[model samples]
Target chain A: MTVKVQREDFDVGAELAAMTRGKTSIGGVTLFVGLVRDMAGGESVSAMTLEHYPGMTEKQLEAIEAEARARWPLDDALIIHRYGRLEPGDQIVLVATASAHREAAFESCHFLIDWLKTKAPFWKLEATPEGERWVEAKDSDDAAAARWANQDGDQKG
Target chain B: MKVLYFAWLRTKIGVAAETVDLPPEVKDVGGLVEWLKTRSPKHAEALANSKVVKVAVNQEHVPYDHPLSPGDEVALFPPVTGG
Candidate 1:
């Protein structure tokens, strides 16, 4: 497991390669990359500044990753989230999960992102033409995260 | 105890962090927030919309009523909008 919160950009290819190396049993890898959108609330975003608690951000992310690992048969997992100022079209976060089967890899990867959306300690402040505004958490994200609380029989959501 | 602010809260409160002695009545997160508002007008304005504000104790996400100890690290900010 690898979790990092940094101000610098990351190389997805390098990370994925490192995660897969020396793991001969791995047959599948699922990865997700999050990008800053150019438009929010019908306004064009000039840039976005992500703020996070220095010590708390990593702790929260590690807990999220640990939860995903416990819920699946994942061979490896990695999450890298970038903080600080970023413009639209910039990569913001990455999540990758590896397992012997595609089912475990895909489900665990999906779970990591869903949990990170609401549980993580990062906040976004966007700069637009009108001025700067703190991004509000959408009800849709809460709803999406709630789906996991309800277990689907023996398998975890 | 250390009370930290972030994002707009930092700007409104006019400081990133400060130390405060927890009064006996300030037993929980809710009580702490209520007491913090009395510190200054800026705090009152920033915490006016308490419903929208989020709190974390010792780096973990918690509800408003979560208990607090004397040395715990508490943070105040808006709801997380991160991906």
Candidate 2:
């Protein structure tokens, strides 16, 4: 298990390679990368500043990763989330899960990102043409996380 | 106890964190908010709506009714929009 919150960017290929260096037992790997969008709510965004609680962010992420591990037969899992100011097209987060099969890898990867959206303590402030505005938590994000909670038995890997 | 604010709450409150000596009447997270509101108009305004403010006790998310200890670290902020 690996979890990190940093101000610098990350390399996806390097991270994936390091995660599965000598793990021949792993059959499949699933990854999700969250990027800073140039537009939000139909407005053009110039920059996005990510703010997070220093200690609590790592604690919450660790808890989220642990939950995914407990629910799946994952050989390894990695969560790298970046903080501080970022412009459009910058990578904001990466969630990768490796398992012996594709199903566990795919589902656990999705679960990690979905849970992170609602449970994590980071907030985004987008600088739009109008002004700097804080992004609001979407109901769709809550619904996304809720589906996993609803189908707990079927999704267990 | 150390009380922290973040995001817009930090901006509105004009300070990131502060140490406060709680009165005897403050025993839970809800009571802490009520007591903190009296610190200044900014505190009262930022924490006016209890429904919008999220609380964490000692780096863990908890409900407003969660009990508080003498040295517990408390944080207040808006709903998380992180990815």
Candidate 3:
């Protein structure tokens, strides 16, 4: 698995290809790309700046990936998050998971992103008409992660 | 000890970092915050609201009770809003 926090753009296809390289056992790959939205909570966001703890960000991401691996039979996982200034329509994050079956790969990929939403140390500053404000955490994200927790017994390895 | 501030906290505090020798009784992040509240009127005002402030110990998210040792790095910021 590879987790990177960088200012440069990433190639999702290349990353997935490299992770799945030399692995014929993998039958499915699931990916998620999170983009910077132009509007948030009815406010127009002109630009956004992302900041994170340099050394601990990657460690937190790896721990999240480890939790996903414990729950699923994933072959590989990759997370790439961008830091620094970004505008609307810019790609903010990419999460990809591969496995021998589609179920584990898809579920684990979704789980990783959901967990990262709240658990990761990165923060966002949005520029609005009034002024720049730090975005607030959403209840919806907490609910999304709760759904996975409620399904503990039904998971199949 | 060195204290680092980031994001909205930095904006409110008006400085990115500072160094000070906290009292021996200020044993953790929460105690440190309470001590900071006494440093200046602005600090007391800025940290009075907990909903806007988040604390970290050595770059990791930590609760108020997280222990603090001499020379340890503590960071204060707002809750994350990243994607």
Candidate 4:
């Protein structure tokens, strides 16, 4: 497993290739990338800035990825998140998971993203036409992460 | 002890971080927030809506009742909105 927090953009293709170069047992790799949205809270966002508690951010992300590993039988996992100023359409985060089967890879990827959304220490500020405003955490997100609270063991794999 | 603010809280509070001596009466995160509000009007405005402000002790999310120590690091901010 790997976790990276960087300001520079990453080559997803190269990252995936390097991750699965010699892993013949891996049957599936699931990847998800988050981007800066132009529209947010019904306003037109011109630019955005991501802020994070540097030391805590990495620790939290590693913990989140570890949780996904514990829940699924996975071969490898990676999480990349960016910080600093970004324009619309900029890549913000990426999650890649590999497994012998697709179910574990898919579900674990989804779980990692969900947990990262609420558990991570990163915050966002969007430069809207009205002005800059801090993004609020949606209750729906907390509810989404809460679904795993009762999950005890591997039910889908 | 050190108190760090992030995002809008930093903007509202007009500072990123500050060092302060822990008061004897302040035993937990909630008490710290209450005492911090007295430091300035900006702090009061930023922390007025306690429901929206979140706190972390030593970089770990904790409830308001979480205990504090003399050398601990405390961060105040809004809920996380990232993926």
Interface RMSD of each: 0.8, 0.6, 1.4, 0.7
Residues A1-157 of candidate 3 have per-residue lDDT tens digits of 8888999888878888898999999999999999989998899999999988777678779888998999999889999999988999999999999999999999999999988886677889889998988887787877776777778855221
In CAPRI terms, where does candidate 3 land?
A: medium
Model 4's number of clashes is 0
Off by over 4 Å in 4: A153-157
The local lDDT score (0 to 100) that residue A119 gets in candidate 2 is: 84
- For model 2, residues B33-53, the per-residue Cα lDDT tens digits are 999999999999999998879
* lDDT by residue for model 3 (B23-83), tens: 8899988889989989888788879987667887776678898899997888887766666
Q: Which pairs of residues clash in candidate 1, taking residues 3 or more apart in a chain or in different chains?
A: none
Q: Which stretches of candidate 3 lie over 4 Å from their true place?
A: A146-157
User: Cα deviation of A70 in candidate 2 (Å)?
Assistant: 0.5
The TM-score measured for candidate 2 stands at: 0.96
- The candidate, 2 or 3, that scores higher on TM-score is 2
Task: Provide the TM-score, chain A, model 3.
Answer: 0.92
lDDT of 4 by residue, A48-123 (tens): 9999998989998998888889889999999999999999999999999999999999999988998899889999
Clashing pairs in 4: none
The Cα RMSD across the true interface for model 2 is: 0.6
Task: Please list the Cα RMSD from the true structure of every candidate, rounded to 1 decimal place.
Answer: 2.1, 2.3, 3.1, 2.6
- For candidate 1, the docking band is high
Between candidates 1 and 3, which one is better according to TM-score?
Answer: 1
Positional deviation of residue B1's Cα in model 3 after best superposition, in angstroms: 2.0
Error of 2 at B59 (Å): 0.6
lDDT of 2 by residue, A86-134 (tens): 9999999999999999999999999999989988899999999999998
Output DockQ, candidate 4: 0.84
Which regions of candidate 2 fall more than 4 Å away from where they truly are?
Answer: A153-157
